[model samples]
Structures are given as structure tokens and as C-alpha cells.
Target: MSVQLVANVLIGIALVVFLGYRQATWRYLDPTRIWRTPLIMAIVGVVVLAQTTTTITTTDVVFLGIEALITVGVGLTMGSITRFRTVATPDSKGRTIQSRTGLLGAALWIVLIAVRVGLDVVGGHLGAHLLTSTGTILLVLALNRAARAVVIDQRIPRDDREARGMMVR
Candidate 1:
């Protein structure tokens, strides 16, 4: 078997494990606080992108950069939507609007990929993908933390009131 095949298999296994872990944790453990969904998706995207690598070119780098920018804009929009929904209509129906945090997370992953491609295009002066991935991972971690802080600080009281059957009016 080729090294690429081996890497692909490993990545697949890792994704499976991550999914299992997420499902189990959400179902039986702590559903409210588990924030691994974004990180997991990011890892899966990176793995898929890495596995499909042909000869890298400037065009590829530019395309990746454009895609990354678009994804980030989408993610920011999603985050705003989530914040709006969570704030403006808290208890209308929990199942109505989809959460946008996942989109933001996916965008972060794309940003990492774009950074990697950029580094490669710049003659690989750095560790390319590894560094880019690490930086984006850190950014994601910070974003998640900030988001949780905002939710905890702002949303909890509203949620509690709604749970107590108190109408906001």
C-alpha cells in the first residue's frame, strides 16, 4: 500500500473516532458544554484537502486564498445569525434556526488550508501546513472561548427565564 493510502486510512479512523466521541458525549455525558464539533470538522476538512494534493501551483494558492476569504465571510455571517437568533427569539422553537457556529468553525479550517497553500507558494519558508493549522486551531480555540463567555454572560439569564415558563413580555 502507498503512504498516501495509509495516511488516508488513518485520517478516516480519526474522524470516525471523533464522531463517536462527540455523539457519545452529547448523548450521555455533557451535551451543553461540549465544543468539539467545530474542531472535529476542521480536522476532517484539512485531512480531505491534504489527501487530494496534486502538484501545487500558484493558481491553486490563489484559488485557495479566495475560497478561504469567502468561507471566512460566510462564517462571520453565520456567527452573526446565530447571535441574532439566540438573542432576538430565544424560545420560539429550539429546532427552527440552525446554529451557525459550525460554519464559522469550517471557515477557520479553510483559513488554515489557505495559509498553508500561501506558505507553500512563498517558497516554503515555514512549516507550511503545520504552522497554519496550529495558528488557526489557536484562533478557533479563542473564538470558541469568547463565544462561550458571551453566551454564559448574556444568554443564561434569558434561557433560565424562558425555562421557567416566563414570557419575555
Candidate 2:
């Protein structure tokens, strides 16, 4: 292993740790319908990336597909475990309070990153580029976000107008 790669990775890990913890500090963020498309796009884009990559093999894609499913399952479980509080009162901005009881999101973020890093490291040793590829990382993140969004959406209540429509504000 190159010393430079080790140093760079160490720095990256440190940054991720900091950011993961920081995410927990958020009291709450409004769940607007605006985020739906982007989150869905994130999930689709990774699959497209996988199909377009000529260097990756069929076996790699299958493995990644399995990993994606597993990640989604775990993410869903964790997201459900995460506590959300919808305050009865809307803010001055007229936004509902979508809050978490603990650092579950932060915890999920760390696990996602750690899993990606672990796979990358092992794949490097085995010459499995797919396992360590950018598409894999994006897929993990996309699935994680999707699961959380699904759970949070179920937790927050929307008005009749919003519910009647496809969007939730």
C-alpha cells in the first residue's frame, strides 16, 4: 500500500467522521416534495452508470446488485429505528417540523461510508473493480437516502391538498 493512499484515506475518513456527526446536529429539516425527484434520480443514475461502464463485468454487476439490496434493507431498518418528531406547530415560515429523536441518520451515514470503504479495500486486493467503483458507492448512498425518505414521509402528515396530489410539503 502506498503511504500517500493511506494518508489520503485517513484524511478522508476523518472528514467523513466529522460530517457524519454534524448531520446529527440538525434539529429538523422540512420535507418538501422538491427532494423526491432528486432522490429518485440518485437511485436511477447509479444503475445507468453501471450499465455504461465497459470495464465492469457481469459478475461484478450481480454482486453490486446484491450489495445494493442488502444496503437498502439495512438502511430501511435503521431509518425506521430513527425517531422523527412532527411538531404540531408549523414554523414562522409555515413549514412542518420534521425532526429526529437521535443520531440515527448520522449512524446510518457512517455505516454506509464504512461499508463502501471496506468493500473498496477488499476489492482492491481481489482485483474486483466493481466492488470499489464509484457506481457502487453512489448506489449505496442512493438506496440509503431513498429508504430514509420513505420512512420520514410516512412519519410526517400532509394536508389534504398535498396528500391528494403526488407531492408532500
Candidate 3:
């Protein structure tokens, strides 16, 4: 791979780790913000779909369909890991707040990135494209974020939802 490609991959890995940290430490944000992630994911999916429409074939269609299902399952699984790993403790004010260093969130990012890179390497040598499409990536992200948002939101008590940054049991 080119130096630039390597650099990009490293940067992407860093970005994922950072985002996972944010997710792990996420406290109760605005309820309206709940839609932001899904909306962004949808927009990204649309843009990716639009760019690839011309190249899509029947085989690609089937592959994309299968990929979407797999992404959802994997996304939820990872989200659950993040949820289970996230540490919630009460602040001095007696409201729950997630810990800053989310080891589980970092693990989630590492696992996903490793799987993607591993599959890409194997598939590339086999002359097949796996997880190589924008649709595939965007869908995975959207599903993960949406599912996490739902899972986390549901866990927060209704009163805490309105509170600034407290995580309620």
C-alpha cells in the first residue's frame, strides 16, 4: 500500500477509537439529538447509494442486501458490548455520569476495525470485494449508532432524559 493509504488507514483507526470513546462516555444529551445520528446515517447512505447506483448489478444488489442484514446484527452486538462495558457512576451531584476512559468502547472500535481490515485483506487476495462499498460502511455505521442510541435512551429514566448530563438508573 502507498504511504498515503497507510496514513489514511491509521487516521481512520484513530477516528473510530475517538468516536467509540465519545459513545462510551455519552451522557444524557438532548432528546432531539437522538435523531441526529440516524438522520446523518441516512444521508450518508443516500449519498453512497447515489454514487454507486451506476455500478450496481443484480449480484451487487443481493450482496448489499445480505451485507445490510449482517451489519445490523453485528452493529447491535457491538453496541451491546459498548453498553455493557460503559461505566456509569454518580457524580458529586449524585447524578450518574459515564467514565471518561471507556475501555470497552475502545475495544469495540478495535474489533470492528480489525474485522474490516482482515476481511479486506482476504477478499482482496481472493479477487472479491468485501465490505468495499460506501453503502456497506454507511449502513453499518447507521445501524450501530441508531441501535446504540435506542439502547442507551431506553435505559435512561424519563426524568433523566430531560436533565442536562445525568445518567439515571
Candidate 3 overall lDDT versus native: 0.55
Q: Is candidate 1 or candidate 2 better by lDDT?
A: 2
Q: Which regions of candidate 1 deviate over 4 angstroms?
A: 1-35, 83-169
lDDT-sorted candidate list, best first: 2, 3, 1
Candidate 2 ranges beyond 4 A from true positions: 1-23, 33-54, 86-89, 157-169
Among all windows of 10 consecutive residues in model 1, the one with the lowest summed lDDT is: 22-31
Alpha-carbon TM-score of each model against the true structure = 0.34, 0.65, 0.61
lDDT of each residue in 1-169, candidate 1, tens digit only: 6575466446435643543343232121112333454555556556654654455556545544554455455444433433322334433444222233344444444454455345445533522333223333334333443344333333333434432211123
Model 2 scores a C-alpha lDDT of: 0.58
Q: Write the per-residue lDDT of candidate 2 for residues 41-100, one digit (tens) a residue.
A: 576657656575548666666657766777787667755765544566766766555555
Give the number of the best model, judged by TM-score. Answer: 2
Better of 2 and 3 by TM-score: 2
Better of 1 and 2 by TM-score: 2
Instruction: Give the C-alpha miss distance for residue 24 in model 3, angstroms.
Output: 4.4
Q: Which candidate number maximizes lDDT?
A: 2
lDDT of 3 by residue, 1-169 (tens): 6564475466566668667767567553443455476668678767865675444455545545654565566556544554322236655655553422256666666676666666556554555442465545666667766765655555443445343322334
